[model samples]
Target: MASGASTKEPAAAPAATAVPDPKMPPPEKPADVRRRSYVILSFWLIVLLLGLPIWWMTTTIYRANLPLDGMIDWADGKACRPVFPLQISIQADALQPQEAQHLVRLIQHAIDDLNDFSGHHLRLQLAPKDDRRIVQKDNPELALTVRLKAGEATTASLDPHSAALDITYPSNAIPSPTSTSSPLATYIANELRSTFSEEQSIISYLLSTSSMSSDVRPQSLTPTDLAELDKRMTRSLRYAATYHLTFSLFADGSTPNTWDIEEAVEKYMRPLLDVLSPIHNFTVDTQLQLYATPGVQSQVLHKEDLASFINAAEWPLSPSIGGAPTVNFVIFAGNQTIALGDSESSAETSQSWLIPQWGTVYLLSLPDATSHVSSNILRQPMLTFGGHLLTLLGTPQAGSLPLRLSALTRIRSADLLLRSSSTLGSLARLSRSLPSISIPRTVADGVATSMYHLERACSNLGGLEGLMHARIAEEEAERAFFEKSMVGQLYFPDEHKVAVYLPLLGPVGVPLVLGLIKELKQWSKKRKEKAKEAREKKQQ
Candidate 1:
C-alpha cells in the first residue's frame, strides 16, 4: 500500500535516469565528456581551417584566364577575312585631267569585268601630273605604275629594272569623252590583266587551300589546277625570318675543286638577295667537298635518280647552327648529261633540276684537267639557281622580277595569316578537349600576345605592316602551343586525387568520426534530461 502511494508520481524521476542506458557503456564523467567534445571540435577546426587550405594549396593547379572565345572565333575564320586590295597608279601626263580620268574609268571597268576572285582586288588611281612616282612615302599600296603615252601603235613593255609599265598608244586611240569603250582603254586593261594574271591565280590558290569562309575562296579552281598548285606549294619551304643559304660544291673527281664562288655570288646573287632582303634575311656560306660521290652514280640521271642525287652522309650540308631553315644549293661537277630521250619543248631545256624544298642540283660538265671553276663558267648555274630560288620561295611562274617579289610579299602575308590562325584554332580545341590540363601563365601571355598581333595583321593585310605582325603572331602561337609546363599535369589527373587524399583522409577520419559520434550522443542524452526535469518541476 505505501509503495503504490509513492509510485503514483515520483518528482525525482529524472535523477533515477542519472545512470544512463545500461546498453550504453556508462555515463561518462563530466571531465571526460568535456575532453572528448574538445577533441572532436579541435579535429573539425583543423580540418576546416588548416587541413583543407593546405590540401588546396598543394593540390590545386595554376590556370590563367584565357581568351577562349576569341581564340575560337579566329580558329573558325569568323574573326578575319583576308583580302588583298592591290593599288595600281596610272600616269597620263600628256592628257587633260578629265580625259585621263575618263580613260581610267573605262580601264577600271574592263579590269573589274575580268576579275573573278573577290579576295584579290585591283584598284587603279590616276597619278598626279607634278610628281609621277611608283610609290609615295605615305602610300605603300602601289604595286605597279603604268605610264601612258601616244605613239604610232598601242605598245606595252615592262621595265625590267623596276616595277613600271611603259605603254604607248596611237593618237587616235585616246578615248573621247563620249566613248564608253575605247580601244586604248581596252588594250591597257588587257595588258594590266596579263601582267597580274599570275598574281591573281596564286592568291586564288591560297584562298582555296585555307580554312576561310567559302564566300572569299575561289569557286572556279578545277581539280587539276588545285593539284598542280598544291604540288608547287609543297615544294616551297615554310616561311622564316631568316634562311641559311649553304653553297656546297661536290666533285666526284679531284679536278674542279676550287671555284670563284664568293666573287660569283657577289656579282650574280647579291642583287637578287638585296631585292629579297625585305621578305627574308639570307646568310650565305660556301663549302668545298672534293672526292664526294653523289648517291646516283649512273651518268644519265632519270627522274628517280634526281631525288637520291644528294649524298646526305658525305656532304656537310647539315642544317645551319641556328633556328633559321637551311637551303642547300649543291653544284656537282660531273661528265654526266641528262638524257631527254622522250619529248619536251626544246626551249624549256635545262641542265639543273630543283630538289623540292631542299635546294637545286646543277650537274655541270667541266674539263677533266681544270682545277678551278671560273666565274664565267658559273654564270648559267647562278642564273639557274636564281630562277629555282624564286620557285622555291613560292613565287608565281610568270611575272616580272619586281612584280613577282611584290606579289610574294602579299602571298607570304596571307600564308602566315592562315598558318597562325590554324595554330590558334588547334590550341583552342586542345584546351576545350582537355579540361583538367593545367595552363601556365607564360602560355596564357603567349596566346594573348599572339592574338593581339594577329588582329593587327588582319587590319593591315596588304602592306608590309601586316607581314611583320603576321610573323610575330606565328612565333608566339607556336611558343604557347608547345609550352612545357602545360604538358606536366597531363600525366596527373582527377582520378589521382582520390588515391593521394584517401591515404591521409582514411586513417585520420575514422577516429575523428567516432569521437564526434560519442560527443553527439552525450549532448542528446543531456538535452532529454533537462526537458524531463522542467516537466516534473512544473507538476510539483
Candidate 2:
C-alpha cells in the first residue's frame, strides 16, 4: 500500500521538461521564405514573358499578301472578255464618193449576213478615191485600196507586197443605188471574205484554244486541221517581245568553217525580219561550228535516225545569253538524207527536220573537198530556215507574210493571256491547297502587277501593247505563283514538336512547378497555424 501511494504522488510532480539553448538564434528565422518566393516568381515571370517573344519574332518568315480570290476568278475566265475589231478601208478610186459609200454599205451588209463569229468584227470604211496624190506615194495612206478599173469582166487580185485589192469591173457591172445585189458587189464581197477566211479561221481557232466563250467556238476545224494546229503549236516557241535568231553552221567534220552569213542574212533574212519588226523584235547572230558530231554516226541514216540525228548534249547550239527566246537554225554539211519514219521506203525524203520549239536542221550533201559555204549554197537553206522559223513562231499558213505576222502577234498575245491566267489559277489553287504556306507581300505585289497587265492585255488584244502587257502579266503571274517565301517552311509534325519540347520542358518545368506548389502549400499551412494560435491567445 505504501509503494502504491508513492507512485501516485510522484506522478503529480511536474514532468521533466527539455528546453532549447538560447545562443543558436532559433535556427536562423527560417531564412525569409516570402522573399525567396518573390525572387523565384520574378524569375519565372521574366522567363515566360521577355525571352519567348524575342525567339518567336526572330524565327518567323515574312509573308506577302496576294489576292487569291481575284486571281482565281481571272484564271477561271470570270474576268475580261476578249474582242478583236479589224478596220478595213476600201478605196474605190474610179467610182463617185456616193457610189463607193453605197457599195461599201452593200458589202458590209453582205459580210454581216455571212459572218457567224460574234467576237471578231470587220468594220468597213471608204477611203477617198480622189486622193491619187496620196495613193501614188511609196508610203500610201491605206491598208487596202480597191482600184475599180474598167475591164471586160469583174475580177479581183491582191498586190503581192502591198495590202491592195485591185478590182477590175466592167462599166456595165457597176451597181446602181436601187439594186440590192449585183454580180460585181457579190464577187468583191466573196473575194474579200475568201482573202480573210484563213485569218478568220486562225483567230477562231486561237479563241477556241484559249479559255474564251464556249458559245463562239468554230465548228469547221477538222481533226486534220486540229492535228496541224497541235503540230504548229508544239513546233512554235513561247512568244516573247524579242526573239534571238541564231543561225549556226554545224558540220560533222572540220571543213566549211567559214560562211558569208552576214551578207546572206542581210540580203535574204533581213527583209523578212524587217517585215516582222512590227510584231516582234529580231536579234540575229551567226556562228560557224566545226567538228560537230551527229548523235547517230551511220553512213546511211534511216528514217527513224532523223529524230535522234542532232547531238543535243554535244552540240554548241545552246540558248543565247539574252533573256529573249533563242531560235537555233543549224546547217549540217553531212550527206545524210532524212526521211520520215512513217514513209521509210519513200524516195521523197526530206532534207531538213524541225526540232520542236527549237530551230531547223538541214542535211546538206556537200563534196568533202568543199572548204567554205558560199552564199549561193546557203540560199536554199536560209530560205527553208526562214520558212520554218515562221512556222515555229506560229505564223498563219495562209495570207501574205505581213498578214500572217499580224495574225501571229494576235495569237501570241492570246497565248500569253491564257498562260498568265492559268498561272494565276495555279497560284490561287496552291494558296488554297497549302493553307500553312505564308503569302508574302512580294507575291501580292506580283499578283497585282499581273492583274493590271492582264487587264491591259485584254483591252488591247490585237496590237503590240497587248503583247507587251501579256508578257508582263505572264512573268508576274509566274513570279507570284512561284514566290520563294510562300514555300520557305514546312508544316512541323506534331510528333516532331513533341519530341523537341519534351526533352527540355519535361525535366525543367516539372521541378519548377513542383517547387512552387510545395512552397505555396507550406506557406498556407503556416498561415493557418498562426491564425489558430492568435485566436487561442486572444481567448486566454
Candidate 3:
C-alpha cells in the first residue's frame, strides 16, 4: 500500500506541476480560431444568400418572352396558308342578262379547266353596262373585263389604258342557256392563262423555295424557269421600306470630276422615283471619283475582264449612313472598249453590265481628249441605269411601270415578312443554345416590337399597310437578333471565373473550415462532460 501510494503521489505531483500557470493568462485566446469561424460562416452566408444571387442577377440572360412555338409553326407552314383570289369581270354589251350569265358560267368553267394550281382561283363577275365611263376609267384593280361584241371571229387583245379584254366574236359562238362551254370562253381562258402564266409560276416558285412544305407547291418547274427565278432572287435585295441609291461617276483621269447629276436625277430619275415612291423610298447622292483605276488594265476587256472592272478596294461605294441598303450606279467614262470572249460572233453592247447584288456599271467611250461629261451626255447612260435599277430591284418584267411597281410592293412585303420571321427563329435558337449570353432589356423591347409588327404584317398582307408593317417588323427583328452588348460579353468565359476563384477562395476557405470543425469538436466534448457530471450527481 505504501509503495502504491508513493507511486501515485509522484504521478499526482507531476499532474499538479503540469497544471497551467496562473501567471501566464489563459494561453492568449485563439483569435485565429474565432476569426476563422466567423470568416467561414460569413463566407458561406455571403455565398449562399448574397454572392451567388448577385452573380446570378448580374450574369443571367434576360431573354424576352417569345412565341417560339408559333414562330416555328409559321416557319413550318403550319400557321397560315397562302391563297390568291383573282376577280375578273365580264361585260357583254351585245347580249341580254341571260346571255351574259351564260357567258360568265362558260368562262368560269373554261378557267377552271385551264388552271392547274389550286391556290390561285379566278372568279368572274359581270360589269355594269353603263356609258358613264367613270368606272372603266378609274378601276385598274379590276383585273380584266371581257367586252363581247357581235362580229366575225375576233382575236383577244388587252386595252392599253384599261384592264379590258376586247373580244368581237361571232354572235353564234355565244353559249346558249343549256350549254356549259363555248369557243369564246375557251379563247378568253387561254388568253387569260397566258397573260398570268409568269406571275403564277413566280408565286409557285416563291412558295416552294420558302420554308413552306413541298405539298403546297405545284408540279415541278422547268429548268429554264428555275434558272430565271434564281437569277431574279440573286439580283433582288432583301426587302426594306427605303433604298439609298448612290450614283457615282468614276473616271480614270481627273477631267470629268463634276457632273450635273443633281439636275439629271431631278429631271429623269425623279419621275421614276416618284412613281416608285409607294413601294420604295429613295435618297440619291452623286460623286465624281478622279484618278480611279479599273481593276483590269487591259485596253480591250474580255468577258472575264468584266468581273474585275470595278476596283472594289479603291471604289468608295460604301453603303450609306441610314439603315436602308445602298445601290451604286457608276458611269465609268474611259477610252477603253470591252471585248467579248475569244468568240468574234459575240456582240456585247452598251459596254455595260450588272453586278449581282451590287449595282450596274456603264462604260461610256468618248473622244480621248474630251474632258467633261455634261448632263446631256449622261441622259442615255442614266436612262440605261434606271432600267437596270428596276431589274436589280426584282421588279417583274411584265406590265406597265405603275403595275410593275405595285407588284413589287406586294413581293417586297412578303419578302420582309419571311426575313423577319426567320430572324426571330434564329434569335430564339441562339438564346436556347447559348445559355451564358446576357440578353438586355433593349432586346426584349425590340422582340416585342418585332412580334407586334409581324402579327400586323401577317394580317394585312398584299397592300400598302402590309408593306409598312413588314418593314417595321424586319427592322425590329434585326435589332433584336444583333443586339451589340449580347455579342460583346461572350469573351468573358468560365476560365475567367476559375481564375478569380483560385487565389482568394483557396487560401481563405481552408483555415475557415478547419476552425469551424475544431469549435464543433470542443463544444461536443464539453457537453458530454457536463452530462456525465449531472448523471453522477443524480446517482449520489
Candidate 4:
C-alpha cells in the first residue's frame, strides 16, 4: 500500500451470536420461579381487580331514580281528572219557599237536559229569603245570581255592572212542585244557557285539548265553534306568575319621543291591573326609541304585511330577563294605516291591530313638530290596550269581569297542570332514551315535588287553591327537565374515552402480555422434559 493512500474502514463486523454456556447456572430454584410468576400475576391482579374497578367507579355517572310510571300516568291523563263545579244562585224573595224550590229543581233539570258535558256542571242554590244582595262581585264561589221578578212578560237581561241576571215572568208561569216541565222553566234555562254558552264552550274546549281523552265532550258544539275557540286559545299568552309589560314608542323622528307615559299608565292601566292582580302580577316599563323605523314602510299596510311590522333587528324590544314572560306594546308615530281590505271608513277608523301571543301595535299620526304626547291623547290607546290585554289573557267575551276572571283561574290551572305533566313526560322519555346521561338528585327531588303538587292540584281543581299547586308543579317540572348537568353529559362521546386511555394502555400493555407469554412457554417446556424422563426410567 502506498504511504498516503486513503482507505475505507472495514465494514462493521456482524454481531456475534450469544452461545449458551454449557455450565449454566444451576436451574432456577423453584422458589425463584414461583416468585417470578407471582410478580407478574400480582401486577395483573392489581390491574384487573383493583385499578379497573376504581377507574370504573370514579368514571361512572350517578343517575337518581325517578318515578317513571307515575310521571307517565300524569302525562297520559290517568292520574287526575279535572272537574269544575260552577255554583249558581237563584234569587227569588217574591216567591214562597216551596215554589222557589220547585222552580230551582225544574231549572236544574232543564239545564241538565240541555248539557251533555259532565265536567262542567252548574249547581243552583236558593238565595236567602232575606238576602237582598243583588250582585256577588267578589264572590267567585257564586258564579251567577238569577234575580226573578213578577212582570207583564218573561224577559231576561244581564246586569252590565255585575254578575246578576234579571229575569221577569208572568205570575202564571210559576211551576208547582208536581209539575214535570213548564214553559217558564224552559225559557229561563235557554236564557241561562245562552248567557253561559261561551264559558261552557271554552271550558269544554280546554278539556278536549287535554291529554286525558274524556267521554264527556261538547257533542253540541259545531266545528265552527271549535275553530273559533281554537283561534282564541292560540292567540292567548301562556300563563305565568308575572307578566312584563314593555311599552315602547318607536318614533320615526325625534318628535313624540317624550310622552306622559307614567301619568297615563297610573291613571288608565293601573285599575285594570288591580282587577287582574289576584290572578297575575304585572310589571310595567316604558321606553322611547327615536329615529326608529318600522319593518313595513308604506302608507297602508296590508294584513299580510302586518306580520313583519315589528322591526326586531333595530328595535330594542328584547324581553325582560326575569322569568316572567314579556308582552310588548309598541306605538309607532307614523301616518301608516292598516289595510284590512274593508270599507275606507272602517279602515280609517281602525287605530290598532293585535299580534297573536305577543301584544298590540297602535298607529298614531302625529306632526313632526309635536314634542310631547299628553295623557289625554294616550287615553284611547291605554283603554284599547287594556281591552286587548284581557283578550290576550284568554278572558271569555261573554261574562262580567268577576266571572271572567274566575273562569280564568280555572283555565290557567288546567293549563298549568297539562303543561307540567307534558314536561314530566318529556323528561321521563329522555331518561329512558339516553342511558349515558346523568340525572342529579335535584332532578329527582323536583320530579317528586311536581308529582305531589300535581296530585294536590288535581284534587282541588275548581278552586283557587288548585292554581297555587299547579303553578308550583309547573315550575318544578320545568326545572327538572332543564337540568344543566344532564345536558352537559351529551358532549362526552365514546371517542373521547379512547383518546384519553390509549397512551397509557399502549406502552404498559405490551410488557405485561410478553411476560405472560414467556412464562407459559417455560411451563410447557418443563412439562415435556418431565414426561420424557418418566418414559426413559420406565424402559430401563
Root mean square deviation (Cα) for candidate 1: 8.3
- Writing each residue's lDDT as its tens digit, candidate 2 over 248-365 gives 8888777987889898898789888888887778988878888998888875567667778878798877686579888988888887776545555657666887888878888888
Q: Which segments of model 1 are wrong by more than 4 Å?
A: 1-26, 138-141, 217-219, 342-350, 525-540
lDDT tens digits by residue: candidate 4, 1-540: 899999999899899999997886888999999999999999899999999999899989999999998888888777877666777888898899999999999999999998766767788888876544543443445767899999999999988767778999999999877899989988988887787777777877876776645444654678999899999999999888899998888889878768999999999999999989988999999999999988988778877788888889999995865888888888888898886766544545466999998999999888769889999988888898999999999998876787677778888887888889889988988889889899999999999999999999988877788899999999999999999988898678889989999998889999999999999999999999999999999999
TM-score of 2: 0.80
Q: Which of the numbered candidates is closest to the native, going by highest lDDT?
A: 4
Candidate 4 clashing pairs, residues 3+ apart or interchain: none
Q: After superposition, how far is residue 449 of candidate 3 from its true place, in Å?
A: 2.2
lDDT by residue for model 1 (372-489), tens: 9999998888988888888899987665788778888888998898888888888888888888788889999999999999999988888788899999999999999889888776
What lDDT does candidate 3 reach at residue 519?
A: 73
**Would you list the C-alpha lDDT of every candidate in the order shown?**
0.84, 0.76, 0.75, 0.86
Candidate no. 4 TM-score: 0.84
- Measured with C-alpha atoms, the lDDT of residue 58 in candidate 1 is 81
Summing lDDT over every window of 10 consecutive residues in candidate 3, give the lowest-scoring window. 6-15
Query: Candidate 2 regions off by >4 Å?
Result: 1-37, 40-44, 130-154, 167-193, 200-220, 252-254, 296-302, 339-347, 490-540
What 10-residue stretch in candidate 1 is worst by lDDT?
Answer: 341-350
**Lowest summed lDDT over 10 consecutive residues: which window, candidate 2?**
135-144
